[model samples]
Target: MIENYIATHLIDVAALAILCYLIYSNNILNQNRKWPFYIGIMLTVLIISSEAGTIIAGNANGDLRFLNIFCNVFGFAMSPLIPIILLAIYDVNILLTNKLLMLPSIVNMFATALSPWLGFVFYIDVNNHYERGNLFIVFVTAYILNLIILFISTVRTGQKHHYPIKAKFTALSLFVIAGTSIQLIFPSVYSSWHSVTLSLLLYYLLLSEFDGSFDALTRLHNRAAYDKMVNRLDGRKLYSVIVMDINNFKEINDTFGHDFGDTVLKKVASVIRKSFDNSSTCYRVGGDEFYIISSETDPVKLEHQLKCMTNNLEKERKNDGRLPTVSYGYSIFKGGKGIGFQEVLKEADDQMYYFKKIQQDMKKSTQTS
Candidate 1:
């Protein structure tokens, strides 16, 4: 029995150990946020080990009955927490924001803790064998509820951040749901922890890739991501590309400092991100320059987004009098007439420079007057 248990869980534990090492060596997580991930790793390891203990003690005689009860209680009490830990790793404040989210897990823990005496969740018989009590469904319900909460949180977070890999996150959540559901339905299957370990590894890889594609300063998609998107554009679909440049950005940097300049860039990026819907992809292509690609073919809607950005910037200017305005120009591709992305980009660039020149001329006239 111990050999079978080892055979089943050895690979999962080893994979988690390697992941922990990689996370430590690469410094993949921010210093402030590393604890949740470490906690998750530790919890997963503990759960796996306790499960093995349960399997071994369940069949043994003598004083091992207490060991069997402890292992079962520990497994039942902690199983629901893995999802919560995963959610915390995604965003710790989620649990804080919704205090009620922790209620189910807390209740599960209480029930599991008392099961040895009350036998409400599970119990160990005189023969040192494990048996489920009448309210075994309580454990299953709590586990499933936490899984659902995790799934919803993942989707909402992706949408809130306008993450490009939102679908991938959704798929990962579904993968976890399916894996756990399978084990719940068929208690003989020991695939749950293994599935979770694999999911964690895959999630880390996906997040690392996603992070590399974003600009560190503005949190917008970077130049390489923009280029990749352009290359992947379907010729049969319409695309509207807008290019924007901050007015007097060099002067701002010179007068204030790079730190303030970075602040301005982040503010502008935030406005731009909020001005458009999910169909739009925003990129910071160069210093003080940004690009937006939207699938919306309607000229009026695109103009409205531009107006929205202008209004948002105006609000920022009110907060900081030194905040500069942005000049933008857009070109629309009507699909397939042999029109290339570069041509559209050049047109937008030319229009942007023309508007920028107009602004320069106006400023000079005002100064001279």
Candidate 2:
């Protein structure tokens, strides 16, 4: 019995450590304010409860740390909330007014806190072991509700938008929901494995999302990532897509060598990264072409940013005499409708060519003079 308990405890501890590593390494903990706190609290509660259960089971025979069971239950119950909160962080506008969606999480935490007096979760004897009490039903119901909400939210969001990484998230959410639901039905066999498996799956999903969407060279999202965002078009949001290319890029590679061209591309990418919001996605689509899909659809802000970027490039050219000028064309989601993403891309490309032609004409006129 003691050996079995120790082995289980070891597995639980390893799971928690893995969760912590994923949260830190993925940088999700830093992306949103409440996500880290919420996920951290959930994991901490589980670790404490599991260890307490193991120690109590080994030494006291069910008499102590009865509260630890409640902690474990509530922590597992509330785990589903993590992904919902994460999705909200990704799509900030969707759940802005949905505090009710959090009622289940709140209730679980409250139940954990108040379980001692109410004896709502479980009670223990002097031996440091525990058995589930009647109030566990209430906790289970709330937990199931949280899991349902998370699954629904993930599905709805995945359907509403086609982010390159959304499918992976949606699939994992379903798995979590399915696994959690199985635990609810067969608590004796499924409970311990559910959270551990879900945590591991989530870690892989996050890693895959990061790699598929992010450009290694520039640390910006890649073309596949941009396609993911573009395909999910709701006619209500205001935003613009900016397509830009560095003029005469091949000449740079031919004259200064590919290494210098790469340096120039990095410089351009850095400028874009510094110029945009942390939430905004940037991508390198071609050798010298880049795309910035500003979810901020406001034409005014879009124009302002593009103009500022253009002006800065001009200033750099004046100072260094060799700075690359970016030709850009942007299209607003006029009234939240457009022909098609591909069409808009083509329009932007055409306008870019027109602008490049004008620049060439001006250069020739100056040479003739």
Candidate 3:
């Protein structure tokens, strides 16, 4: 029994030390995300301290009632926070850097901290043993509800930004859920802390990879992510590949200089993002070019959406006359169609060239008139 306690406590301590090392040793901690990283470190350290307290408090000669209380408080506190931390990881504005959105977490922490007086979250018994109080169910329910909301918000946010981090979050949530279940079923195991530590570690490692997938200029998914998305397609889902290019983008660069040209690209990216719905994936495939992939299979709905995208881009010419014009072409293929990626891209490119020619001719005719 002593050996078991020692091992669990060591693992918890090791996890905290490693996390701290990652933060201090790396430049990955930037201003936009430092708070989430700091919060994550806090969660890990609290768990480590609580677990270590549990070990020391188990000593018969030790008078560590405060340690027992701290353990219970920190333990209850960390569970509800996993979901909140996830919101921060994704850089979700509402959950991170927004005090207003933190009301739920604040309320939860306050309620959980009432374990001593109200016996709602947990309490230390006369023997200095930790025990779940009568209202423990309420805390559990609150944690579960936070997880649900986190999942919904993450998926919806990912869809809005054309990111696919929901799968990662789903995996982490499931792991925590399973670990929590096992701990509840067999209270002696003390495995949930280990699971959480490892999960947080892996999640941060994944977070580090996010920068490579994003385009620095536009903050959209870059060509690397584009390749991954295309290569990993299951071939069963209906895919619409819309290829777009700016009209005479070189002229803008030459006329206004690179700085203004960069502004144009950013503006174009914003317009494209706004035009597409959550169901579509947009990529900055190349300079002055973009690729949007959609799984919408319904012809009428798809065409309607495509038309709206077209109008959205065209409207900018009238709305802001200084914005550069863009043209696009799309080719969709379903399962068993045997259409190669290059072939479809070629088709779209061909159509784009054809459209560009028409626009050029119209300009020439209007000038001659």
Pick the winner on TM-score between candidates 2 and 3.
3
TM-score for each candidate, following the candidate numbering: 0.88, 0.56, 0.83
Candidate with maximal lDDT: 1
Q: List the residue pairs that clash in candidate 1.
A: none
**Model 2 Cα shift for residue 16 (angstroms):** 5.2
All candidates in order of TM-score, best leading: 1, 3, 2
lDDT (10s digit) by residue, model 3, range 133-206: 78776667766777777778777776676667789878977988887778777867777778777777777776
Candidate 3, position 327, lDDT: 81
| C-alpha lDDT of all candidate models, in order | 0.86, 0.62, 0.75
Stretch of 10 with least lDDT, candidate 3: 26-35
Candidate 2 wrongly placed segments (more than 4 Å): 15-62, 65-102, 123-138, 148-162, 193-195, 216-220, 223-243, 248-282, 291-325, 328-355, 366-369
Would you give me the overall lDDT of model 3?
A: 0.75
Candidates sorted by lDDT, descending order?
1, 3, 2
Candidate 1 residue 327 C-alpha distance from true site, Å: 1.1
Q: Model 2, range 1-369, lDDT digits (tens) per residue?
A: 555655665666666666656655664232553354346435544654554464444365444455455445555455545555554644455566687777776776676555555556554445545455567776666656755665566556543333444567666656665665675676443343445445454644564465556666776667777776777755566556778889899998898888888877887787777676643567888678898776776767777777777776666668666568888787766553446667667777787788888988998999999
Poorest 10 consecutive residues by lDDT, candidate 2: 28-37
lDDT of 2 at 285: 80
